[model samples]
Target: MSATKASKLYILDTNVLLHDPKCLYEFKEQDVTIPMTVLEELDDIKDRKKNVAQEARYAIRSIDSILSKATNSEQITKGVRIILPGKDRDIKLGCLSIFPDHELTVRTGFLPIEHNKDNKIINCALHLQSTFPHRQVVLVTKDINMRLKALGAGLKKVEDYRTDQLVSDVELLPEGHHYLDTPFWEGVDKVESYQRDGKAYHRVARTLLPNTFLNEYIYDSTQDFAARTVAIDQESVTLLDLGYQHLMNQSAWGIHPINIQQAFAMQSLLDPDLDFTIFLGSAGSGKTLIALACALEMVIEQGRYNKIIVTRSTPPVAEDIGFLPGTEEEKMTPWMSAISDNLEAMHEQDERPQSSVKYALEKANIQFKSLNFIRGRSIQNAVVLIDESQNLTPQQLKTIITRCGKGTKMVCLGNLAQIDSNYLTPLTSGLTYIAERFKDFEGSASVHFQGVFRSRLAEFAEENL
Candidate 1:
């Protein structure tokens, strides 16, 4: 039997637009409808200084730009055509319509006509469903509760706006290293080792997995050995020679590696060739402690850079908190408390009797800067540390990274699961974005911290609470 297929109609929620202004054009050939209520919500937040407001303004502007070319509002009601420009000009932009909430005629009487925004938006989609009985209507939103209500009201096909998701599953996201099965050494029967500039190298013709990329680390549990691929060409890989004992024996600024992951982080932080490094972990994983320790060793001990420059997105208060009276550094002290916390922890943990927190800060020549005026300034000859960086958007991260000058080593530390910005998700955060994008870049390394060295209570809270 042959039956005509129903067309798909997707109605967007306010959060989708606020999360990603470009969500309007991601629907491909499916028809898109934006209720007037969602636009009303956008207008309310369009004037603020935070990222949400900025995205709302952009969405509003994009809609206006397309609608300006339309003949009239009635044209939009009937379905207005929009053109998406790109190298592949054949992108099928489905029709976009502004549906009025009051015109909804779904269920006839199941839901009452109300001034509430969610009800209005849902009712609009319900109306579209009733009007086109042969069509499938879906409500798209990043808000969980909204999706629940839509389903409760008999709507189907409610889904998360996945245009910005970087990975299909959280656990599958790169941990920057892999553990090899037993007999790893025996498989490498043709292994060759050599010395270069007092360092080591290895060439192996082992049967490796297809996903092995440049700078990929392979850890062997039986022999307790680890190696990284320096070069890869299809069937063979050249490994930068290294062993577990050497890494575990090292300490940076009196801070020894508490786990294998921290050891890798310290190595990456101390490597001058790796001008860029990223650390990802949850709370109490010692990510920041290891990074700050290595920065101190490099700047104050090794004389690699002039100073330690720290900055992060001023989140948890992107909008106005209140007026503060102080110089720039003084004003930034409250936000830099985490930096001071780790710095003081380092000083307390230093093995030397004469070690002092104040003296260490002075010796390191550390500077706490803000992201507000980071634009147009070239930061050179410094060890740049960006903490709590998950709050940054990808575009914002690009803006900050592009400002790195010659001889500057940039380091980022953050937990993707703890992102606070409403405009971001773990899969779309600046930290994950950069990690996935820069995994193959030369002299760039990323490490995922594994253990929680803090109090047992803290560990319990992280796992249970």
Candidate 2:
């Protein structure tokens, strides 16, 4: 209840709730008030059969349930207390009568819905803020334009709901020009200590580095051993286990070039101790394979997690098992093949316990869940892999990440360049969204697989065509 203690009343925006339904709990004993317009938007999105819609539906249901328990008032259910402040308020400005619907909606320069709904929502916020002059009234929205308008309207405060990355300290470095020396190549091998003229080396390669601040050389290798420059991109290199061992003693898991990506991913995944880490790459980039291998090592080899949990976004994104018709396993046959194929390829065994991942699910006690049913449940001590994550929106991504319980590590993998969503672009897509946000965090690392390594034909088509 920090916001309450500070006398700050946050008006929950619809997109914020849709982005993360459980954000209500995030305040943790804080004063959060849901706008009546958010509820109306939720009602419309609740039964659309899409993940975002389903999330909207689930959030409202949860909030209603909590309120019902707390107050015994059916009107306000869940943790959210819906209020329509606009019921008594009249439009002070006559702009709507003079302008078209689009103009009215665009006048304030923010609209999540059609012109009419947008105006009503803004009006509702304006009315509520006017009533609570003593209290610090703030509008919390996921829509950028909405937040801008709220600030411009002379509200107490306005902020975006950034649930993904909360960057505390920002750091930046000069481009291409880097400084490197001995001990920088301590752990990595085949690192010939050679410097290109006017080009900097940071040993490790990355697409983007953390932001710079306070006029500091963020890439000081002497001070921080792990501080790396961003000039180099990791090449598709072959790797063998670092230790000297008999040929048969080495595990097949780390032998493949694909395994290198997974090994790096696993290293990052285990850190931060958070529930989720998203990995994005092209086909043959070892996203699914490494995730499965790492999950197996964690569950079976390392004894860190209790079970392996794998799921995919159903089409239009994942296959629809409903039309195929059979047992639960039979229904999930097509979608489960990705996991099975990765397992088969990893083990290099034609003969296994079960041909289908569904059967493997039964034998391994691994949960092959669909994203649709993961609303309220919190998965614990499990290695959860969500494939085809590129198809998800920023909102859908947040819902899944919030479902991770203590001791659970969730991995999301999909190719951003290979997107099929008509409504999203690369910058707005989930994969890039996560990468851009979390790249500088201590427990996170993002590597984009550039070259196609699956097959020569695939590589040729990727590069030439």
Write candidate 1's Cα lDDT for 1-465 as tens digits. 011232788899998887667877888777788888888899988865454566688899988876777787787776765568889664647778888765553445345655567777877877777778788889998777778988999887788887767776667667877787774676666777889988888877646545766666677776467777778766678877667877787798889997778877887788777889889998999988888888889888899889988887776564432354677677667878887888777776566624577777888888887775566789999999988899887666776899999999999899987988766678777788888888788778888888777889988888888
Query: Can you give the lDDT of residue 223 in candidate 2?
Result: 30
- Candidate 2 lDDT at 324 equals 62
Clashing pairs in 1: none
lDDT of 1: 0.78
TM-scores for all predictions: 0.85, 0.53
lDDT of 2 by residue, 1-465 (tens): 111243656667777777667666555334566656567779887866556777687688756654543443332322333222256783221000001223334444343545456455565456546666777666777666666776676665776665543332212211211234544345354442334553233333222223321111122244333222223224412111121112113242343333333434544454433345666666876677667766766666567878877776666643344566776555655777888877766655535534544444544467677677676789888888878888777767767778888888888888866766543445456666665555545344454444566789887776676
TM-score of 2: 0.53
- The C-alpha stretches of model 2 lying farther than 4 A from their native spots are 1-45, 55-255, 258-262, 269-275, 317-330, 350-363
